[model samples]
Target: MNHDAYPDNYIRGILNSVKSIAMVGASPVNVRPSYFAFKYLAQRGYDMIPVNPGHVGKDLLGKPFVASLRDIGRPLDMIDIFRNSSHIMPVVEEALTLDPLPKVIWMQLGARDDAAAAKAEAAGIKVVMNRCPKIEYGRLSSEISWMGVNSRTLSSKRPPAPTQGMRLSINRMSVGGGDTAASDRAAKNKSEQS
Candidate 1:
């Protein structure tokens, strides 16, 4: 798979097939991009397990922050890397240790390791580098276009209405947990500003 030119079907296939994600290098801070990405992906229906040694035994958005991928104790379809590009090899190594290895290893924007990607791909794992799942979901699902972001592919036909009852959860343990309330509040504040 060419990381430089991923076709829509290839990207959509992975996103559609994945149900659970373990986000390594997740953060507790609200202003960080990882935090926002975690919240968005979770709300979009992916069971998000946040991995951060610094926040081990702590909770983020209702889900317990695991110290490492091995501690997740459940099957993860994908592992989204949020660390620096230089640090991806170790993360991929750890991911490869899992009994039922994740189907995909996604390196977030600005983070890419060709050697690590090749290793994972050799082991029969799909790899996506230098891309963000949240952004891809929005772009593929046309949600970004709704926000007036120029997504490049336009159509005269109206997009379908968004599904209702998709509220962000605040009590990290709730069905939609993790500082969701904070996200809601931030959204509300933004709406008020408008």
Candidate 2:
């Protein structure tokens, strides 16, 4: 899988539409990314089912944890995977075997298994690889609310500012509607007259 296959629109759609998510390999450890991501989404009004074999029967974020997708015993909109690529296939296989399969399979950053992804995609499951739902949600949902990025901001990182005049002009043109061509010509004429 070209890592770029995960589109922003797809991520946004999942983030908006899915009310309940089954988070595989979800950890209760505060330091883990999955723990924070799951908590963040839950706080955003998503019903998060924490799935980890070791954590079965444990409580996380006021919800009872299940060992696997099958143990959850209900329909799920999506599964946000925090597991490594090597451990993904079994989860994909199990997801397929669910009575009501999930709509999407999202693999977190640095996690991508082509064969597992193919299986999910072939089963009509929307596949997102090498992306974090938390980061994508922050971006597409406009939750960042800041231009500059830092430890304070949640975006992956911002690209450098445009260097060329044409790039700046195009950015302005894309946002505002006016007689831009005529305005440019008039501006050029005024500059020449000066």
RMSD of each: 11.9, 15.0
lDDT of 1 by residue, 37-145 (tens): 9999998889999999999878889999999999999889999999998999999999999989999999998777889999999999999987789887877666665
For candidate 2, give the lDDT: 0.71
- How does each model score on lDDT? 0.80, 0.71
Candidate 2: C-alpha RMSD to true structure equals 15.0
Q: How accurate is candidate 1 locally (lDDT)?
A: 0.80
What is the Cα-based TM-score of model 1? Answer: 0.81
